[model samples]
Target: MKKICIALDYNPNSEKIAAIGHAYARALRAETILVHVISEAAFYAMEYEPFMGYDSPFHLNNLDMVKELEQGAENFLLAASLHLGTDGIKTQVLEGETSDAILSFCRENRVDLLVIGTHSHSVLENVLMGNTAVKIVRHTGIPLLVVPTKMEG
Candidate 1:
C-alpha cells in the first residue's frame, strides 16, 4: 500500500483506531493520512441541550457552530497525528457526510487502504454518526482495516 487513509471520529475510540492504522502504515512503509469527517454544525448543536437554566444551544447559530466544528476537527486531527508520533503524517478535516467524505478523499488521494473503528461513544454519536463503517465498506473500492473498538458487554 502506497497511501493509507485513517478515518477518525471525535469519539475516544478513535485513538485506538489511529494507532493501529499507524502500525499498518509503518509495516507497509506507506504514507499516512489522518482524516476526520464532520457533519453540519446543526448536527452537533443537539449535544448542547438547555442546561443550568440556560436558554438553548440553538442560540449558537449554524455559522458560529460551523467555524467551531471545523476548528475542532482540525485540532483533533493534529492531536491524533502527534499522538501517532509521526512527523510525516498528513491531517485533513473534511466537511459533509462521514462515509461520503471519506470515500471521496480515499479516491482522490489514491489511497490503497482505509482504517476505521466500529464503535462510537454515545447514543447521540450513534444517531449523528450512523453506521459509518457499513456505509464505507459498501462503497469504498480500497482495502479496509476495520479495528474492533466496540466495548465488550
Candidate 2:
C-alpha cells in the first residue's frame, strides 16, 4: 500500500490540511501518517531573556519551558489524531526543523505524497517571518498538496 505523510503545524488551517489528506488518502487508498514537528529552538526564542551562565537559573527555566512546549505539542498532535481518526487517518508527532523532519520521515517511510497547510501572507511578511510550507516544498522530492487557509467570511 502507498504511504502518505501530512505535515501539521498546529496552525489555524490544520483542519483544512487534514481534510485534504483525508480526501487524497481516500482516493488513493493509501495509509496516512500525520506528522507534527515541534521546534524547541523556535519555542525558546519567542521569549526574551538576558544572557546567563551555562548553569544559570535562566538556562534551566528555558529548558523547562521547552519541555512544556514539547508536551503541549504532543498533546495537540494526539488531539489532532483523535479528530482525524474519525476519518481513518493515523498520526505521529516529531520534534525538529519542520521541513527537514517531514522530508526525512517521508524518505524513511517511502511516502508518495505529502500534505501541508499554507498561510496567506505577503512576500515581505514571509521574507521576514519565513514560511514552513515553502521550505518543505523546496526540500522534498515527493508530490506535495498545499492547502491554503481560507479567508474568514
Highest TM-score model number: 1
Q: Write one digit per residue (lDDT tens) for candidate 1, span 15-119.
A: 889999999999999999999988755565555556798866555675677788889889989999989887899999887888998999999999999999987
Candidate 2 residue runs with Cα over 4 Å from true position? 41-58, 61-64
Provide the TM-score for each candidate, comma-separated: 0.80, 0.78
| Winning candidate number (lDDT) | 1
Error of 1 at 55 (Å): 6.8
Q: What is the lDDT of residue 87 in candidate 2?
A: 56
lDDT of residue 20 for candidate 1: 94
- Writing each residue's lDDT as its tens digit, candidate 2 over 1-153 gives 388888887676898888788778878899878888876455563545445534434345677777777778778777776876655567676767778888888898899999888888999988997888889878888898888885877
Model 1 Cα shift for residue 13 (angstroms): 0.9
What TM-score does structure 1 among the candidates reach? 0.80
Runs with alpha carbons beyond 4 Å of true place in candidate 1:
41-62, 120-130
